[model samples]
Structures are given as structure tokens and as C-alpha cells.
Target: MNRPADKPLYAVQDIPGKGKGLVATAKIIKGTRILSEQAAIALPFGLPDKERRKIISQQLKTLNNDARNAFLSLQNRFPTKSQYVGIFNTNSLCIKTSTDEGSFVDQAAIFLIASLINHNCENNAQQSWNNNTRRHNIHALRDIQEGEEITLSYVFSLLDRAGRQALLKKSFNFTCSCRLCSLPIRESQRRDGNVQRVAALDEVAKHQRSTAPLQSLQCYHCVLAYHLSKYGREDCEYAQAHGDVATLLVMYGDLARGRYFAQKAASVFRTLLGSDSNEAAEFAAMARDPSRHPQYGFSMKWKTSVDEIPYGLGSADLENWRWERLIPEGIAPFADIPSKEHFVKGGTSKKRHWCFMGEIVKTKLLHPVQLEVKDSGDKKLALHFYSSNTSDTGNSLRPGQYQKGYTVVILDALQYRFEFGCGINQEDLRMMKIFPLRLAKILALNKEVREFSIRHDDGKRKCHGCGAKAAVASMKRCSLCLSFWYCSKECQTAAWTTKAHKTDCKSLRDPDLRGLFFYNWDEAQDSISFPLQVADDSC
Candidate 1:
């Protein structure tokens, strides 16, 4: 039991069910790099049986007395008698599937220090491959308290109590008894349901092609956005999430969204796994310049430069930026539709973004059957006039229509009772509305409204310090204020000196400010006012 001077930080001791494990000496802060050691013995990936034996045998010959003793002390859970096999079984960790292509085999050089760290279905540390250093690194994903075992997850997905037990028995060979794995049957069932839902979403998210009930960006967000509020585990899963999204976007030929999601994934992985990790490095490179990607310029549908990130949007707005769902399409923007409103009570489905936009091809009037005859897709639909639009000719509406184009906003496609009567069928009035303009003309007018009414730019790049629209790629915003960019030294100087951007810049650079630019406010449940502070930048 000879432990190092960092005594209270960690000590080698027997762990119940999981052999000799390292117990926390003192509280370990999340994101703190725990240890970094050179590999004592290393070999090329996927060696033949004879070659693997030769490599391990050669490495054993070079070990000093102390190193040999350390190697001998690891827990060997395997039913093997050979010391060589025992050490290999005891000191091994999962070789990443991404880096080491094959089955879930163990890396032989995983040190005693690394191997002594135990497993928990819900772990406090994240382990990742740092390809640059050809070493593995562990960072505290959440704070680990003193006297607690520093644990990491062996499997990728968040499993339920039953799922976790099964995986442990089949793969890592242990029955978990962690707090999360030991809830009461009912409570455990609820937690398991949540885990299963999250896992199901993750699986659907990763392999969307194979999953049924296919979803779009809007649909995925509708289902998974609630997970942020529901699970702490999802916070660590952002990298995987962004990667899945990036993959989906790429397949759809939307490089703009693909690049954005890839960049976001890269950022999250870099934070959790370190920038040198393959996931971080690959994504970071993709984010830097999307054109370099093999699929770049594959389609011009959603084209935008990487530096086109907005200057002053709120958190939800920034999320829209990251997702590329803010762009206009045939349907209403995803940000404009609320998921709760899309589904009825007891899980009945309501039409999403279904609104009637038609032109008045003809008009007929008769008491009750008073139809404002209109052209809906070149077919005449009976729009029984029901509004209290009091007129001199109350029931005698004419053939010459009052307007050429008319618009209608319909809520749930429900039929209601008609109080005013003229023998008009209530169903006819139920599906129709008259808002004076055709759908095509309405959309044109909407574009003009966006153009002339709003004083802001088209969410393009401008010097943060000065109100100058600089070239997108060449501008860099002040890191602190983030609200403004500078084209060059002169512009940055002007911002810092003459414009008083120094103060404004600092205020705008706040994470809350950044968060504002990230969150979507159009279909928001809660009103997000100005001076938005950053809550957490997980998105």
C-alpha cells in the first residue's frame, strides 16, 4: 500500500467487485487533466498471435524491478494462469473504435495508473484518444469528491440498470451497483425509460438512415431538445450529437449545416477530449474552412462561408446559426413552430405548419351558402363567408371579388359551430379564412417586409468595433465584446478609442451575450430580453 506523496488525492486500494482501484485522494475538479504518462510498452495495432506474444515478451524483458512490480499489481479478472496473460487482462483498457479498427479489443500498453481507474455506468471522468501524442488522456468530466472512486464509462451509450448490468456481464465482466444502477424498481423503471429514450434518440440520431419515422432538423430538435433539461448525461454527449448531426447534414448535401454541426462537435470534443484528440482535430479542421472537406461545394443550396457567424443575435439565435434551421424554406421556420403545440393532449398529432394561402378566383353570394369562391390550387373551394364584416348587401355578395389575393391562418384543423346562419355548412367555413392577399403574393410581401422594415443587416459580418461591413473571411471580432468585428488595425483602434466600443465590446462578449446569439427566440416559450447572459454554452 505504498502510495505517492499526493496521498489524499488518490490511493491504491481494493474496490468492491472491481479489484484494486484508485480512490480519490482529494476532490478532483472536472476537466482537470489527471495524469499524463509515457507509454511503458507500445506496439503497432492488430498484431498476429505470435507477433503479439513476441512484442509483450520483449517489453517484459526491458522492465526494471519497480516497473515490473507495478505491472504485476493490476487486477486480473480473466480466468488465466499465465502471468503475461494476467497482466495483459488486468492492465488493458478499450482501444477506441475510431482509431483502432476492429472488435472491442484492449490496448496492451494501458498503464497500471490508467488501468487502476474503475468503471461506473455513470462516470465522472471522460477517456479519449490523443492521436497526436499517441497517448490516452483522462479528464474529470464532473467534480469527483474525496473518498469517491474516480471512474470512467467503458461503453459509449448511456444504458439503463438492466442494460448496464447486461453490458458489464458480457463485456467488462462485472455487475454494477452504482447509485444510478441501484434505484427502486419503479424509480429504476422511470430512469430506465428516460435512459432508453435518450439512447433510442442517440441511436436514431447516429444511424438515421436505418431508423424508421425519419426526422429532419426540425423534428430531431423537437424530440431531443428536452433532453438538455432532463439529463445531466446529455451534456457530455454533445460531441457525439454534433457529429451525428454533421453526418446527417452532409448526407443531405447541406454543407453549410454540415460544416456548422461539424464545427460545433469539434469544439465540444476539444473541450472534453483535448484539442489533440482525433475527433477534435478532425472537426476543428473542418470548422476552420469547410471548403477543404471532400464534400465541400457539393451543393449550392445552403452555401455560406465559415466566418459568416452573426455578431449580435441572442443565444437561441446563435443556436439557429449553429443548426442552419433559420434559413427560409417552403414550410414555416423551425424556430417559429413549438413542439408542445404540434402534439395534442394524450398524444394526438396536429398538422405542422399547415396554413391556407389561396387566391380569390371567384366569389358567389347567397344567404347562408354565402361562398367567397376562391382558387385553391386552381380548384374552386367553398369558403362560406362567416365574418362579422357588416356590409350593405349582407347576404347578396357578388361575383366581382373585393380583392385578387387573400390569405388565411388556420389553427388545428377542427370544425366548429357556426352561430350566424344562412344555410351555410359549418364545415366549409371551418377550413377557410380571408386575410386579403394570395399566398404567393403574401410570401413576396413577407420578403419585402423583412427587407424594408428591419434596419439591421442580413445577419452578415461587420466590424464589431465599427459599423462597417467587412469582407466575411477577413474580419475578426474582439474576443471580449464579441458583438463587433474589426477589419484591420485602424478599425480596431477606432472601435477601442473613438466609438467607446471598449466598454460595449466587453459587455457584449459575455457568455450570456454569446448565448443570446445561440438560442432561438421566434417560437420560444419564454421571452428572452436583451443583455442576455450566458447560462451554459453546452450547445
Candidate 2:
């Protein structure tokens, strides 16, 4: 093997349960290169077992005595007549190399010393193929004390404890006793839950390219959160999550946060892969100029300049701005609204609960009642009622209540393509609700909820009556709307009589209106039922 000129940081030693393993001989700091060596023996892929065995034997015969002795000393988990093939199978690292045709091909190579590094679910080191040097490189993922065994994970990240144990036993012929695997049952299960969420978020991110910009951003935010919480900022997956979130943000026209996340991704990539790596270079370019991204300006829904990022905020406030997290302060219980155009048919599983809000523009009673509606974005769509029983449809709304300007909210709304055009088909009466307010007024109220309801660190609420900000826990909320806070009955009376709360209170008191905001729109694991409760306990 072509070893680097520098003295090695680790040495091969006998591990207690594991046969031979690599252990640090000196303290190794995080990001330090532990080893760099050329392969001792390399074999091409896709060849038949017989032919491959013959090739490996011939190659073994050609090696010098020292090299041959080292290769023979490697582990052979699978004993077979072809000893050379057995040694190679037990200790080969997959590397990419150029073939005779000048195209890249995957080759398995045996590294004499590096192969001795054992597996750990919570490894302290990472092994990567450095294509520029044409050598296998191992780096410390965290500080390693002298005499500590340097380890790497053989399986993918975020696997649960049971999954990790099963795969290690089935493939490696060993059971892992890593720190993560040795945790108590309750903590192990909690970690498993987090890992499962990370995996689900990853699955969602894979399809973000085809999803609507807003939906893609939402998925990326969730993915980033899980990665950061489980893996920390230094983990490769956490850096990758930042990069993905940056891309989606730029696609949706949020250049400020996009640039911020891109810079973070670049910094992490530089630390993990060295400053000269292609990944670091690419992200550095993105951080410098996010608008140059191919997806820039696709949707200007959240347009912002690169320098528009906010300053002087606490960590929580900063995170809230970065993720566009919805605060529940003034929000009606189940009032989260999602655009109809973003809903996919069967492909859109419940990532989170969402409702569609639109105003009735026209109504037709065909085989099933059809209502023409206009969304908050001024886009026109149709909602068709398919209930056979009038009690479930017409009886739910008084004759004049279905007239123009009335707002309708449907939970778990989905897009359906019909002969006429694409729209929503309503089948459950419990999922549908109508309010006397206009679509604009309802949206305005939602905006107010977004603004005043969120509690600040100072424990203050923005008074709906006078626009004053103060600690208002002792204050009374408008009893009718349950949508605003007031310091006293006088303020409440004034807000009711003078601030147009009279009309707002009447609209808000409609059980359907209150239900629209009270439903748990963030719970995505199951379908919501009617007679919507104040909170989703499942979440």
C-alpha cells in the first residue's frame, strides 16, 4: 500500500470482541486526516465469480513478499477454497477509478491497515474516497483520545436500533454494542422515533423538485430540523440538509435566507471535505450569488434580496424567521390554509393537515351540487358535493347561506381532475364549513392571528383593542370571536362597538367558523374527523 510520508496517527491492534482493529496511538482532533493510502490490491466489478477468482489469484502471485503477506493477513469472514477471493471479499473498499476507455468504473480495493477499522453506530471517524489524490482517506469526525478505537458506521445514517442490529448481524456476522445501540429501551425508542422522522423527511425531500415551491420549502424546513436535532451541524447529513433548504428557498424567491443557508452549507462542506473539494467550491459560489441558481425567480412569492436577512433576534426568533414557522398565538384552532394547486392526488400523503379556503362565487345543483369558488390568490376553482343525503349537504347550509361572498373551508382538501377542469370534490359533510365573512376578511383575520398571537420572549401580547403591547395573560379575549385579547371589559366593549369586532364576532361565533381555526392542521399522521376539537392530541 502507498502510505503517506507522515507517521500514522493510529495502529492496528487486537480489539476485545472484534478480531483486529485500528486504534488511535495519539490524540486526534476533529477534521484531522487520520490516514491516506493507495490500495494494496484492486479488482474490477461485473466479472463472474470464477473469472474474478482467477484474476485475484494471478494478482496475488504478482505482489511482492511484504505486500502479499499483508494482504493474506487481512480478515476472511467467509472461508472458501479460493483463499485470495475470500480475503478480498472480507476487506475491500469500493473506489471509483478510470477504466481503459477513460470512463469511471467502480473497483473494490483492499487497504491493509485501514480495513482493520471496525464498525460503530456512533463512529468517531469517517472514511471517504479522495478522488483528487486517488487514495482512500480517513478523517476524525470528532476528537479521539489516545488508545481509543477509531470506528466508522457500515450502515446508512438514521437507522433505528432494531434495524441496525438486524442489518449488522445479517451482513457483518456481528452484533453492535455502540453507544447508540446500548441505550435504555425508552431512550432507544425515542431516538428511533426521531430517526424515523428524519428518514420520512428525507423521502419527502427526494420529491421536492417536482412539488410546489411552498410545499418544497416546508418539507425542506422539516428535514433540516430533524437533521439538526439528531445529527448536529457538523454531521454530513446536516450540512446536506442546509444545502437542500437553500436550493428550495431560492426556487421560491427567498434570496436572503437562501444565501444564509447556502453559506452555512458551504462552511460545513469545507470543514468535512476540505476547502478544495468540489462540493465546497460549488456551495461557496452559491453563497456568493444565490440568484445565479437555475431555479431563481421561479416563484417570487417570498421575494427578498440577499442582504435582507434580519438581525438582532434571539435564537428562537431567528429560527422562526428562517423557517417561516407558524405561531399559534391568535390562530384559530384548525385554520391552516393550503393552496389547492399544490395538492397532488394519491401522491400527496399527509405531511401535515391543511385546509382550503375560498369564497362561493356561483352554485349549480347538478347530479351533485357544484359550487364555483375563488381562492385567496384570486384563482377560481370548483367544489362538488357528492353526498346523496340532503341533510349532509343542503340542510347544513340555509338557502341564502350558500350565496356569493360566503367563505367555505374544507379540511384535508385534495385536487381532482374532472372533464370540465381541476377542482376539489367534497364527499364528507363534516369536513366542510361555511362562514358569513368574505374571503378577504377571513384572510385578513388569519394575518392578524399570525402577527399578534405569537407570544414574544417578553411575555407580551398585542392588544386587539388599542394596538398596545404588554403582558396580557390577565386580559379577556373577545368572548364571541375568541380571536383577540383585551386588558379590560372597557377595551373589549370598545373593540366590539367601534373596531368592527361586532361583525367579526358574529362571523367568528358560527360553530363552523370557530371549527375552521380550532382544528389541528399540523397533525399529518391521520385524517381529521368532523365536529373538530380544539386541539389535536395526537400531535
Candidate 3:
């Protein structure tokens, strides 16, 4: 019956549509702990309804006259007031079930402060049942302006506007007009579809089992996308979603991505829920080393030691690192190569792979300055061209006549700090192509090549020289290129001597050229220009 001595923010007056609610007296920043109190009365679970009623009635009688009268004055939604149990049932929150030990079979606490909080479709506060504390607590998820009613959601899962309205009307005895409740039907449906798809995708990921390390990266991507989208940020769902992603990543061996996700989740939780809360502490531990978790290295595909986190990632890059995927139109050239330092050195060749892609916005043939202009599919790429035709008079292309929207591949690229015409391919014309589309679409084709066409392992290879299926280990590699391996020395000799491997070998040996076969270019980061650089032997 006792209210916190701190003056009530709002007078305990009847809230017209809603039973009785508390309005904020001043703006409350997120993560502010509003109130914490011990329960005045506790009852256990599952006695007969009649017996439970008798117990609550007897307990009420023990309170002082003023406290008893104040307790009885609380609002009731149920139509009938004759039953003492009905009034308690209408106002009391379910604190703990009977399984946990308490005085009564089922324990319910009457929280004077918590019960005053209102419900809203677009709530800025999140309420949690903290079993550790044995009390319900509410934390602000966003800034709550003075005089605004502080509301929390009643439903366990996020409900769409219509679904929320239906549930609220039935259980809470009020219609909600919060921002979510007022969204346009079409926009509302679109956002709802995203939410539903995210849930469905989680189930799909769970149902499909995998034994490899990092095997769940594909599934985690679905949840990651949903949390990053605009709608997910509006609610506390983003933090919870990131926490789920971090947990799954850590279960595998991807401490790099897992730690990044956990840090992100922890940040959000620190904002929506107090930093000292259990959820925040859990994520903080995960952010240190995802692999240190109990489930670390459970799968082999994504295995990484605690020390394997990458170094060069910036703040923005850390975010992209968590997801580690490219948007459909992002410009990324090094998408296919293995990121681990040991793999490139141990597996096959010292050379690392990469490809350059550019959209030909203009073309003009003016001999030595045969200008075939291009774009990096992004404005940030700084689309300027410097000619290295190397002759007084070489063939120039006609403006807008030759392939306009095309990508040109530069082989064995080196950084030329001299000018914009940096990746000077000695044999530029031979490998470059005008694909009649955007650079993004051209990269999509390369993605298909990596996913559907190329074989990754040297142990299992399909020869590009003769189209023969052979184990890479036994095969004799071309002396000049080392890119094409043959079944026998005879096959190798034949490839170089009889087939056109002599020409192909030279092209394949070029590190930039070899990269076209290895990287997962479908996942892009920032804008990539024509002619990607091949990493040095050490990378």
C-alpha cells in the first residue's frame, strides 16, 4: 500500500480509456532506472481458485485501514466487483509461478510503482521479468518527454498494428493509437512481413543442422538484416536480435564476427536496459572473446581462435564485419578470397586473387589516348581516366559507340600513385570486356561463377585447359602459370605444347587474373573500381 516517498510524477487520477496510468513529470533518458522496490505481499501458485481468493482476502485484512482503502481504490477492468479475487486479479501482475518456493502455492506481488505504468503500441520503455531480482523492472528504451505517458508493451512478441490492436482490446480494455497503431495499411503490412520473415528465417536456420565452424553465418545474416533495418530500431528488438546473432556466432568458432555483434548488442542494451543488468553483462563477456563461450569451436567450418580478430576494420567496417556480406549493388572486388592468413599460403599458390570492374560511361578512340572511360559503379570511386596507351598513335575508341556499360579487368595490378590511371594492365584490351550492363550486374555474374562454376580445392579440380576432372595434388601444373594443373606430366606437356595453355598460362599467372577465379564477389562492401589489386605473397 506504500508508494515510494519520492513524490509521484503524476497525480494518481483515473486515466480515461486506460484504467490508471503514470505520466512523466520530466524527460527521462533511456537506461535510467526509474524505481526498484521490495514486494509488500507475495503469494504462491496453483491453489484452488476459491482457496486462492480466501488467502488474498485474508492478507488484505491485515493491512492498516488507510493502506487497505488505498489498495482497494486501484482500478479493475473486470465487470463484476463482488468478488475480492476479481479486483486483485485485474490489477496484480504474475511475478513468479508456484514451482519456485514462496509462502503461497502461486506467488503474485502487488507492485504499487510497476502497476502504475501504462501499455502502448509504440512503447518507449521495456519491461522485463528478472528472475534473479524477484521483481519486475521497467527501463526507458528512448527519451521520454515530460508529461508523456510512459508505456510498455504487454505482448511478449512484437505484434503488428492490427494484431496489437486486437490483443489490446481483448485483454487490456483499451484501443491503442500509438505510432505503430496508426501506420498506413500497406506500409504496416510491409514492415510486418519483414518481422514475420525474420522469425521464419530463424526457424529455418534452426531446423537445418550443420557441423562446420561458422556454418550458421548464412542464417545469422537473416537476423542481422532484420535488426539493421529501420523498423527494427524503433523497438528494443534490435538489441535482442543482435544478442541472438552474437550467441549463435559464438556457438560456432567465429569470434571475430561474434565479438563485433556482441559489442553492438551490449551497446544497445546499455541504452535500453541498464548497463548493470544481466543482459548487458552477458553481452559484455561475449564481446571480449566469442570463442571463450562454452559453445566455442562446436563447428569446424567457422573455427577461429580467440586471437583471430581482424586488424584493419574501421568502425563502419566493424559493422560490416559482423554481417560480412555485400549488398546486391555494393562495389566489392576482393569478395572471393579466403580471409585467413594461413589458408592462401598452405593450400595452393602464393598468389591471392582479385578482379577490377568498371562501367564504361564513355569511349573515344584517339590513337595513343584511345579513351575508354569507366565508372566504379559508385560516385566515390572518383571516375577519372589516365591513358597508358604507350604509343604516339594507338587506336582510339569512338564516344558512346563501343561498349558503354562494360567492365574491364586489369591483370597483375600494382598501385600507381602517379595519377588516376592507376591499374595499368599491360594487356588491358585482351581481358577487358564491355558486358552491356552495370558493374554491379557484371559482379553478379562473377558471383554465379564462384558459387556455381569454380571448384575451390586443389585436391578436387576440373581442368580449364582440357575440361578434365582430376585431383589437384597429382596434377602437374603448367611451368609458367601454376594456375592450371594437369593429371600427368604428359597432360601438362600436352596442355602447354598442344593446347592453347601457353597463352592461357601467362594470363592465369597474373595475380589479378587468378583472383577472378577465387573471391566471393557477390558480397560487396564499398565501391570498387576497375582492376582490383592482388595481395602480396605475405597476405
lDDT of 2 by residue, 380-439 (tens): 887887765666544354566577888887766656657687687777767777777798
Q: Would you estimate the TM-scores of all the predictions?
A: 0.56, 0.60, 0.61
Tens-digit lDDT string for candidate 3 (258-289): 78778888887776656656677888988886
Q: Mark the regions of model 2 whose C-alpha exceeds 4 Å error after superposition.
A: 1-5, 44-47, 96-106, 230-233, 310-314, 325-539
Which 10-residue window in model 3 sums to the lowest lDDT? 340-349
Error of 2 at 360 (Å): 20
TM-score: the better of candidates 1 and 3: 3
Backbone clash pairs for candidate 2 read 329-453, 330-453, 332-517, 333-517, 333-518, 333-519, 334-517, 334-518, 334-519
What TM-score, to 2 decimals, does candidate 3 have? 0.61
Residue-by-residue lDDT tens digits, candidate 1, 397-446: 34343454544433222222234421123232333334444656545533
Query: How well does candidate 2 match the true structure in TM-score terms?
Result: 0.60
What are the lDDT scores of the predictions, listed in order?
A: 0.55, 0.71, 0.55
lDDT of 3: 0.55
Ranking by TM-score: 3, 2, 1
